[model samples]
Target: MASIFSKIIDGEIPGQLLWTDAVCGVLLDIEPLTPGHALVVPRAEIDHWLDLPGETLAHLMDVAARVGRAQQEVFAAARVGMIIQGFEVPHAHLHVFPANSASDFELSRRSSRTPEQLAQDADALRAALRTQSDGAHVPGEA
Candidate 1:
């Protein structure tokens, strides 16, 4: 059976996508610790983050980093937090969100947002991403 992320990648499910590459895709999280929270997931449905090959893992992190930068631009938080507790889906993914303190990293701290809200956030992050990728001065990149 395909994981939910795979279904999203295959277009079987709707996703507010920000970035897509050969190895991975980034999308907004419906349940977010904060606004601009997103996930960077590999195309391959690997269950465990540690089980991913080194190179693949590195690429995932790189994508997550880029998303973090964009989230910082969109949310303007003190920092962007990353979490890899992959229990929600079988596919390996990294949760990246804007954070002002340690409590912002807690999964229990997440709350649901309406689809409209998530979509708006996704759009904001997408715009920030495009600006950074297009040679703009992205926040959090000193």
Candidate 2:
């Protein structure tokens, strides 16, 4: 069975994507701990982060770091946090979100966002990412 992440990756389900490349894509989480919360996921379906090839892991983090910067630009948060707890979904993913405080890290703080909201947020984030020094340019401007 394809994981939900895989479905999103395959466009079998909708996603508010901020970045997309050969290795991975970054998208806003419908349920976000913060307004700019995003997920960096490998295009390939790998259940555990540790199981990914070293190069793939490196590329994922590199992209996550770029996305983190974009989140900072769009949200103006004090910091951007990264979490890789793979228990929630079968596919490995990196959660990149804005954090004003440690409490912003809690999953319980997540709130549902409408598709329109997510799309708007993704648009802003993609614009921010494009302006950053090392940020990626997603096709269709994300």
Worst 10 residues of 2 by lDDT: 133-142
Using all chains and alpha carbons, the TM-scores for the candidates as numbered come to 0.91, 0.91
Judge candidate 2 against the unseen true structure and give its global Cα lDDT, from 0 to 1. 0.85
lDDT of each: 0.83, 0.85
lDDT for position 87 in model 1: 83
lDDT of 2 at 103: 96
What lDDT tens digits, residue by residue, belong to model 1 across residues 21-69? 7888887788899988888899988899999999999998988888998
* lDDT of residue 53 for candidate 2: 97
lDDT of 1: 0.83
lDDT of 2 by residue, 37-68 (tens): 99999988999999999999999999899889
Off by over 4 Å in 2: 133-137
